[model samples]
Target: MNAWSGRQAPSLEDFEEMALAALEGLPAPFRDLAREVTCVVADFAEDEVLEEMQMDSPFELMGLFVGIGMAHDGAAPVTGQMPNQVFLYRRPILDYWAENEDTLSDVITHVLIHEIGHHFGFSDDDMEAIEADAETEH
Candidate 1:
């Protein structure tokens, strides 16, 4: 059994490393798309984002996708515009890990892919299909 070492939740830097590894594990095409998107690891969802999502608590949001999707904006931002960003709430992800059976790496990958789907303007079914393809590659 794993001993409890009284370690705190993963830090932002740790989350960043995990997110990078998750991205690298994805298929080439998907990873290419994700390359343009920045990944941010924060302790919790911002208040404004929570209100926008209608979430009652910070823990309710594991991650978020922000920016104009390729389907809507021709796959590139106009002058002076920001590119896509995926915000992974570290605290929420840690909380979820504690309650779920999946490994931390798997959970991070799931969240990253789901958020990237939003960046691509993909439906849930599309995301599922992409994930399926990724699994088959391994």
Candidate 2:
């Protein structure tokens, strides 16, 4: 039998698990700050979200960070404010994974860390360094 036989795409729950694992795998300092951020996985970007982002396709967005970042208001908690959240679009991620050289776990980790970077108001370069640190620790 072919090595690919009987294989199937990961389900929503599986994606969630992978996302959480990625969060847990971050370096200590990043992981500590990221612990407060919630991770949510969905099949695709919602219509309203796509409209708001001026995106024509759901696949255009793989993940999003929702809530005030540390750079804004020191990330203080205000009354009635929603907790910080990182949303992972599973279908788009899987689609990207299908076309990329990276493994599914690596893709998921990248997206998760990118969103977490938004939560901490870190730049792309900072996130890249964090990812590199994580890889070295593993």
Candidate 3:
């Protein structure tokens, strides 16, 4: 039998689980900052979101960070402001994975951490270090 046996695409819930696992593997500091952020997994970007981002196709976006970052002013909670959220687009990520050299879990972790890095106003170097640390932990 071929190694690529019958395998179904991960469901939304599966994606969510993978995202959460990525969060759990983060360094302590990043994990603490991410505690208040919600991770949402969707098959693709919503049409409204696509319009707002000026994206012609959902595949153009793999993830998005919504809300103020810690480095910004007035990041504290307001009386009625919605909580911070990180959105992971499953279909696009899967498509990318299908065409890339990375494993599905690696792809999921990269997207999750990249979005969470935005939440912390982290630089690319900072995110890369965090990802490296996460890899060691696993």
For each candidate, give its TM-score against the true structure. Answer: 0.91, 0.95, 0.92
Per-residue lDDT of candidate 1, residues 1-138 (tens digit): 556777777779988999888888888898887788998889998899999989999999999988887878877678888878999988899999999998898788889889999888888998888777766775
Compared with the true structure, all predictions reach lDDT values of 0.86, 0.90, 0.88
lDDT (10s digit) by residue, model 2, range 23-68: 8888999999887789999999889999999998999999999998
Pairs in clash, predicted candidate 2: none
The candidate with the higher lDDT, 2 or 3, is 2
lDDT of 3 by residue, 48-107 (tens): 999999998999999999987777744577678788899999999999999999888888
| Candidate 1 segments whose C-alpha is farther than 4 A from its true place | 136-138
Q: What's the CA error at residue 122 for candidate 3, in Å?
A: 1.0
| TM-score of structure candidate 2 | 0.95
Instruction: Note the clash tally of each candidate.
Output: 0, 0, 0
TM-score-based ranking, best first?
A: 2, 3, 1
Best-matching candidate per TM-score:
2
Backbone clash total, candidate 1: 0
